[model samples]
Target chain A: MAVEVQYYVLLSMALFSIGLFGILTRRNALLFLMSVELMLNAANINLIAFAFYHGNLTGQVFALFTMALAAAEVAIGLGILLVLYRNFRDVDVTVPTTMRW
Target chain B: MIYEQIAFALFAFITLASALGVVLLREPWHSALMLGVALLSIAVHFVMQAAEFVAMMQVLVYVGGGLILITFAVMLTEREDATDDTETNADEVVQT
Candidate 1:
């Protein structure tokens, strides 16, 4: 049995939608970060699926770059979460409007 | 035709359910756990699509690295029930 491109695309769409809903509804900062990760991975899956179907390595290479970007994202995201937690004492992202200067 | 479609549908269902759990669960620890499951399922999906290397990296980086960092961050952060001091700071700025 072979997998179809439409199957992967539909799965990616479903994952992306779930991520969007999470980001929209979750007030917690950590959950928001997870949602962002979900969205990024969904895009990566799309790229890889395209790469496989087209027999081109470019899409897989792009997925590698996407994963690298995700690593950078987690670094800066956790750093910000740390600062937000230190000052706010909670990771709720819905509550900040001031800059520390 | 039917068996393959059924298997794919089941996998998709599992992936979506776990991903939903990751966000909907209130406990960050639980969310992290669900995220691990979701990542693993997505990796299986990747393998099913014949993207073997991507699938392996999905498990290695996402479940191994990303979820671990998320759990550590959650643990290090303040508890969910605490009143946010940052709110007070914002209030002070508005008053001044």
Candidate 2:
């Protein structure tokens, strides 16, 4: 039997939900960055699945762009995390309360 | 057809489990390892779906580049004493 597109969609949804849960519940800055990566992968999965199902390359192209963006995001995010660690000696999300107003 | 189904099931199971591990593991290094597993599984899924270019790109970009970045971040930011305290604090918050 051929694998239907819906199965891929379901898998993507499951991954996205797990990532969302991690982002919402995790307090560590690194975990938060990891969750965002998970979410990006979920999106990439959906994009490539649909691209294959539709017999086109647009989704694949977009997925490549998404990967580039994700790389840049991780770079900037980690840079910020490094600075945050240097400043506060911790990467806890709750520790950066200087601008809490 | 059956083989394809089996492959999909296997890859999906691995990807999901490792993704969960990424979020659930207490140690950041372990989580990073799980993330690598999840990314590889996703690359396999891409190959199964007949997106060879995307699959290779996934391996290159995420497994090669992203994993290295995460490792560097983990190494650069890690402090033994502070990590223990942070782990305890995070665990307590998670438990509640």
TM-score of each predicted structure versus truth: 0.86, 0.93
Write one digit per residue (lDDT tens) for candidate 2, span A25-79: 7777898999999999999999999998999999999999999999999999999
lDDT of 1 by residue, A1-101 (tens): 56788888988998999999998877778888899888887898799889888988899889978988898899889999999989877676655667544
Model 2 compared with the native: what TM-score? Answer: 0.93
Model 1 chain A poorest ten-residue lDDT run: A92-101
Candidate 2 residues lying further than 4 Å off, grouped into runs, are B82-96
What is chain B's TM-score across the candidates, in the order shown? 0.78, 0.86
- Largest lDDT belongs to which candidate? 2
Clashes per candidate, residues 3 or more apart or on different chains: 0, 0
